[model samples]
Target chain A: MSQHYYEFFCPVKVVAGKAALEHIPYELSGLSASRPMVITDKGVRGAGLLDPVIEACEEGGQEIVTIFDDVPPDSSKEVVRQIASAYREAKCDSIIAIGGGSPIDTAKAVNILVSEGGDDIAAYAGAGVLKRPLRPFFVVPTTAGTGSEVTAVAVIADTEKSVKLPFTSSFLLPNAAIIDPRMTLTLPPHVTAMTAMDAMTHATEAFTCLAKNPLSDAHATAAVRKISTNLPRVMENPKDSDARLELAQASTMAGIAFSNSMVGMVHSLGHATGAICHLPHGLCMSLFLPYVLEYNLEAIREPLGELLLYMAGPDVYATTPTSRRAETCIAAIRKLRDQLWQYCELPRTLQETGKVSEDQLEAIAHSALDDGTIMFNPKETSIEDIRNVLRRAWG
Target chain B: MLAKRIKPMALQARRLYVETMFQVMGRALQAVSEVDRSVQEEARALPDGFLFEMTVMPNGPKLVVEHQGDGRFQYLTSEPPRPVDLSIQFKHIAHAFLVVSFQEKTSVAFANDRMLVDGDIDRAIRMTRILNRLEAFILPKLIAERAVKEYPQSLGLPEKVLSAARIYLKVATHFVETARAS
Candidate 1:
């Protein structure tokens, strides 16, 4: 048996529940942030979730110098830098990121750029590139998905190059995460389904990937089982506080799992596909999950089978061989995607996205080949295999 | 036959580390009588009617095993005993157990102070191996059951509400997933 060593660490204080957003002042107080920058996107502001947070902070004697609500979807480095400069100009002592991944990630980038005084966000790309911690950052995720509040990585698109720069470091982890399902109550059905599937993919990949260890396995398994059970419910009833809580918890757990154990090809292909096609990351992930799993079955069967047992329950594994379990898991995932697609009206194929084509398959595959995540896949993958997976995902 | 008499709670307690401390121990003890016949035969050999005192502490849980039969047989942790035996510091039990289960190395964790064992070194090694097998077979089921009970609605939700919730969760889950995948 191969002896695998694993360590789990997510020190960010997670404040979760129905009115968990109210706990932000307490978390920020602990960080000694007197004047915090409330970083968010227009969507969150438009939804009016920022009001209570601002009110809560004001009631707690915390001053908010600026509300940078310019963050856009798939936030670019230019936007982050602009915000960072604004934050610095305002002399804000800390950051309070409120929204989905884009704003949270943009806040992380802003923290890095402002604190480290770097002109180019690209200079800090890759793991362990940062020499010091960023600002004292507190994250409140408006969406129930993306557990960006706790992860130690950020993705900022470079519009000039059309490439997403992934800056990773332990230092990028937020000081605290407030995951209140109420923040996600107003989210539309399509966004909810896609983000839930994104959370599911995180848990699934962490459970079945090569780098998975005991701690990650525990978190991933719990996350997958929870998301599988709760995502649908939350999608069906956004007002169901309990289901919303479960998805929030699943999102955080999946975040913790993949952050520690890492993810696999589904993500690699998704990243490349997202960057190239300008499709949403979750949409790309949901579209490619089954195809990539089908491609990886030969190498990932054993673990994937274990995951299948966790996902579909033991009955599915009772008569199936371990090697066959992987395929079954892939089929199960595809079935879920199909169900989700019908429910959310999400695009089921690359062609449905209106941008991707068979002609770009090679480029997408090549980009995936160069992605850092592919290196951790259980099976060795090549550009050719990636091309094949893309073609299959094209439907 | 004596093993048949062992309370279901005791069996579940034996499998406590598997997942939820409550459910696994409950199931293992409930099913104990049917699966392993040797447990009863071994229980017959225990001293004081197979009574074993167990103490779970921060370091490690300790069990004082006494023999009721002729000195030829030894008792450990309410189970039948083998030839060798050892005691571990209570705090290191879980760590030691995990290391032995995954690494298949009994002494390194103990020697490195990640675990500490007292008594016969040989017995400690044997116990680790047994615990490894016990964890592997029992943990997954326990974990699965716990997850199922924890989140029952994941199968499918009402179409109207599910459609709405999907949008938010999709964005959130994607942002985190893509970052980690990268």
Candidate 2:
């Protein structure tokens, strides 16, 4: 056998259980935090998941000094600055990011500002800009997807320029991640399906992308098995805490896998669509997963076949050679998406989200072509190819 | 013909060693070196009329190397032999080779759970000894070359002092980790 090598590094302490939130204080205690800022969206606060975290912090002798719950779905750079200002004024020693991608991303940005003392979020938009470490931060994801709890990236939309800026630094990774299934139990069916699909996309893309290594592949495969097995079960019974924890753990695993290895065209396209059309990030991922896989099948067939075997088992591709199984994997993904669509009644096309049109195709293609994730796709995708994928994804 | 004198056992053992060795070497070169096109081209040029094939796996890539000793090595991807001269199973191909070579982990493939090597114990021992000596000489030069290209600031350091410090730190850290694990 040919020799191979891998480097594994994810330092996020994953606290996963029915009452995983209870472990958050213990996790944070290691970081020496006495006062923490609870950062979340108004939606999460409205859903009542934030109260338990606050109570747990109080019971653990950790003070919640402030609650910045103004984060929106597509978090803007301005929102991050505002939250950072609030954090400073509150004199909080640490941050408890308690929402989905937006609040977590905002918390990351806020930490950057609080530590680095930068006004313009654009200044540190690229990779490896932060030379110093940030404050102790913990993530409590209320969705079973996004995997933001473990990722080193924080994407913030620059509303003024109308583009999403990805801030990446290894130091931006959270100190700990609290994945309580109880937090995700109340998610609406549409959000649940879209977010779970996002997790699956992360695992699948991580498994199939150019930067994939053996370590990433193992994590991605395990995540795919967990998500594929648990997402549907949780969908059937939203209050199934066991299934919810499985999905949550899957999302966390996918997050760690993709964060180091990177993702591919699905995320590139989703970022562009989310930026221009103002759709939910996970919803955009769900709409484009199968389409991008089909488009990039020729070049990424081998890795994609590995994903198929891991997700659906070897029998799914028993009749095909490893080289030709990419199409089979894409077809399986389409079938799964079809089932999820039927289950959640989510939009199957970009047009269903109200932005798909012949006129908008050029902008969507241009945006996707400019996204950094597109570069890591195994195939060389031109603007026209991106346009084709967008047109096909458009209903 | 040269084939008439070749023992099947030796041939199989050498083929397995070369295959695994080249695969690990190629992955390490790719990880630390920025010259991807040149490195891939060089990897495609393994000596001894050898053929190489690689199969990407969930844990890592498996490689098969075939050689006729006619100044060319052919590479192909296929199943590895159950009993071979030396077998190494690592958590990932990149880490297995890089950590062993650059991080100075002596026989990490045998010691760590991330990698396992089997068969022809004497040959394996000889190969590991040779690799360790080669790593001792080559790793510093490789790190220096990469540092100049990757981080220009390293070029200004006083050669003796900087080299001494780096060696000391690496050995110290390696010793501590190895001790803790043991």
Candidate 3:
């Protein structure tokens, strides 16, 4: 139990393993939905991820009324509106999001519109605005990262305003998350590495950040252990179904953990860097995780040290002295990153990406301070401190 | 029967503290807008005529303020005629007291899920920064350090003392006027 008062919530039903995708139709029907609008991206579609999903639905005698697969890598308000229109035009009674973060977020946004009766998502922006349950929503995550499937938040870019609009509510959670290894089997090496690291970061932050409760710690530690043991094996053999399934389940557990406990400075800086440098979200998480742990070392040492057993297993954990466990945890994360870089050229630093300039570090720092996630960081950070971290991460 | 009628809302001591804190916080927003450069910068970043409100849920003390552009703010004596751009509602009076009495920093209170904000989060973050700046200026350094995430390092002791005096005087006058009005 936490000494401080805390609240934990994750109502999304998780359906994982080999038969997960096949069970989606049954889950949708349980919600009294036979007509589902499938939302995904071209990448997942092109990768033939939809074939099995379509086959499953058809075999179950549930029709996918329509599919809007043109979703951009970053879901936009306009795209959401368009999907809402198509969802209405097609008379979609439910939604099935079959991709990564974008499509799932877009589905949640579309569910808001169709269920709540609104086209302008900006009207519903902010926390606790959705006052009712959304339409039947199911997620089939094609990637192992971005626990958007179980999370209660969506970030849709408002292109006209040049700002990311965040919509948060427990209502945004999917009715069920279908985590089938078949869907993620086609994920490229780099994406697999980064997305797994994203899960790693989520679990790490959830365990150490403020708002952490006993329940969240359970999920976070389990996720960390799963990812720590399985990520390397999956990277070595991308076709390993068991490893892939473990990774996917770990991602969902991490999602549940972070959704309740919430993330901290890693996410704040990662979001800022993504906005400024256009780096992938997972890559930013990987780049910033170690540095932030080092920065919040004093405040979060006990929890960080406790995470060593989960992250590095008993051998390393038992060997490391109590005084050095926290630093050893960070070293273990750095070691994992080094291993990932070898597996796939996942950039270890901002400079290696050939995208972020030194001059942009100040802007990133400023932007990060404005981020809501910063409030959850164990250590209160100054712009100078953030800039120092960014500079160090710049390599 | 009378004993049973005494409800949680009738906890007079907590109510008085919450009301007094809200009153002082309202006045302090007005004073800091005039005195603190950082508050002004934050106000300018907000949308024009942005109304910010802080209240406790289930009918507790409420404090409302408006951004009058160019780093100026006005404390509304009554509930605003229009919906606020951002509103942070503490789940209970005790939670509000925890934050108001410097027992919990605003960021910590937020992280602890003691409060809920309705409206733009970015603007809410901006408002929190403004509140942090106000706390740094008005509260004692030792207390302010506990109430805010980071105490402004550049705020010298002399400047803090001088601003705290001016702000407290304004707060005192505001309360006096409220007393007379009531």
iRMSD, per candidate, in listed order? 17.1, 18.3, 1.8
lDDT of 2 at B82: 32
Q: Which digits, one per residue and each the tens of the lDDT, describe model 1 over residues A217-328?
A: 8888988888777777876777887887788888889999888777788988898888777888888878888887877776677788888876777778787787678788
Q: Best by lDDT, which number?
A: 3
lDDT of each: 0.68, 0.70, 0.90
Runs of candidate 1 exceeding 4 Å displacement: A1-3, A118-126, A157-164, A314-324, B1-182
**Candidate that beats the other on lDDT, 1 or 3, i.e. the better one:** 3
lDDT at residue A48 of model 1 (Cα atoms): 93
Candidate ranking under DockQ, highest first, comes to 3, 1, 2
Cα lDDT of model 3 by residue, A1-395, tens digit: 42287788888888988877889888987889988999999999999999999998899887889999999988899999999999999888999999999889988998999999978988988788899998999999988889999899998999999978889999999999998999988899999999999999999999999878899999999999999999999989999999999999999999999988989999999989998899999999999999999999999999999999999999999999999999999999999999998989899899998999999998899899888888889887778889889988988
DockQ for all models: 0.02, 0.02, 0.63
What does candidate 2's lDDT look like per residue over A167-237, in tens digits? 87889999889888889889998999999889889988888776677787888999988887787787788
Candidate 2 displacement at residue A266 in angstroms: 1.5
Q: Candidate 3, after superposition: displacement of residue B64 in Å?
A: 1.4
TM-score of 3: 0.94
The positional error of residue B68 in candidate 1, measured at the CA in angstroms, is: 80
